[model samples]
Target: MTNDFSPLSQWQLDRARRTVHRGGVIAYPTEGVWGLGCDPWNPDAVEEILELKQRPAHKGLILVAASTDQIEFLLAPLDPEMRERATRHWPGPVTCLLPDPEDRVPFLVKGDHSAIAVRVSDHPVVKALCEAAGQPLVSTSCNPAGRPPARHGWQVRRYFGQGQVHIVPGALGGNRKPSRILDIVTGQWLR
Candidate 1:
């Protein structure tokens, strides 16, 4: 019998990619922490992540992509210099802000800012998930507000417990530092 809850497969991964076509929340690995992600288009799913983490919606979230192209809808409108300026930092930990392409973006994801933070990841699994999912996800550190970020699957399980998440199996990437947060406009590191 196929266990309903075995680790993910290429098929399930493909399914996840397709399912996210409509927008939903998911968890995946990041450089130094596991991250919670969702379809930026789905306000309900984004809201679910906020509720799950007890995160204040106004704090905003990051978006992760398989490639700069995955978020083309959000990036295409940027002036060439602005687009080039932002693309220079990607396929790595540096997240940058770009204009929101659609009104579907919730105020929570934009936080108090005028632009949304996004990145194209270098991590293999994150690349695969976004590649398979075929869209950038609303990426944020996986933890309750005021708690430590989860660095391993077990830590993620311990923090959220089994019922809330469909934990994808993987080893954490060997990065000592979490992704650096910067104001793309000011070049200031917020974290």
Candidate 2:
């Protein structure tokens, strides 16, 4: 999908990319709401997000990427049909749980599960941020477990305060709800 939306300044994108590379957490707009993202391979960064949201480690987190190629290492093992099933709903508000047989993903990112949740986002800001970081990022709702996900920049600020997370400037995508999550391996709708 084409991403003509460019709501963020180059400086903002660069700062976010730097923060991710430095193992800091950042809040950026996503398909339905603001999202907290960090380098998925950085365990400390992932822990910071979990702590900020008061989320349990076992729940795992989703990885968002600019394109399927960014996550090709994980998807390459799946059969052609299973891979197609997951890719068909991507570049949009859909997350698919795919088996991580080779354990390419970190334990913190996958939690206790054998499968990891991932999405290829069409949101320009998300795509840009992922591209800037040159890897998939750990994505979770900006709010704490019980709080509503942040839909506005101010909401993100209110939830985590200014210095807690580096806020990447942008507006949420048109989706009114969070991404639909599906377990492609089991053919189950998880959300």
Candidate 3:
């Protein structure tokens, strides 16, 4: 069967966005390597991601954005200093855990903590995706535990072998490394 998620020469981005609209998980480039993502607000979409990765919801997931403001819906009481630091790393790879309110942040994406991991991504397509979705998207590497994360769409398709992530072909950012995870409160390394 032909894959509807194939990367068309021009409408790839729109197709990916539509795929998300249809409650599908997707693979696209990130700051370092390719990442799998879906609408964080869509429970069905989120469930797909969890099932695809065999990830536990209690473990939580990271949300990547084009801007910090995109995460305002999930954040609460961001301190002045920490906000500044987060701003300094935004539009780039640096995931920061920020204060979150239970009412605003959903339990499916939050770990056993009061903080929510958020990233202001440096990837252009990621930024556009968030802008298109009008909110943060669940972002995670496109691989299972103990396996290397896929660096390209072909690798993603090869790993999942089809019908996995709705593939969106594009080049990854030049970083060649994953984002650094930081604790917004203690400035501690969690990753």
The Cα RMSD of model 3 versus the native structure comes to: 5.1
Q: Comparing 1 and 2 by TM-score, which wins?
A: 2
**What is residue 129's positional error in candidate 1, in angstroms?**
1.1
The Cα RMSD of model 2 versus the native structure comes to 1.7
Q: Deviation in angstroms for 145 in model 1?
A: 1.0
TM-score per candidate, chains pooled: 0.84, 0.95, 0.87
**How do the residues 13-102 of candidate 1 rate in per-residue lDDT, one tens digit apiece?**
875676566555566777768888777768887888899899888888888899988978777887787777777878788787776756
| Best of the candidates, TM-score | 2
Per-candidate local distance difference test: 0.75, 0.92, 0.76
**Ten residues in sequence with the least summed lDDT for candidate 3:** 1-10
Q: How would you encode candidate 2's per-residue C-alpha lDDT over 60-170 as one tens digit per residue?
A: 999999999999998999999899999999888899999999999998889999999999998999999999999999999999989999989999888998799998887
| Model 3 stretches astray by more than 4 angstroms | 1-10, 74-76
How does residue 126 of candidate 1 score in lDDT?
Answer: 76
In the predicted model 1, the residue pairs found to clash are: 17-133
User: How large is the C-alpha RMSD of every model relative to the true structure?
Assistant: 5.3, 1.7, 5.1
Ranking by lDDT: 2, 3, 1
Candidate 3 at residue 95, lDDT?
89
Instruction: Give model 3's TM-score versus the native structure.
Output: 0.87
Q: By the lDDT metric, which is better: model 1 or model 3?
A: 3
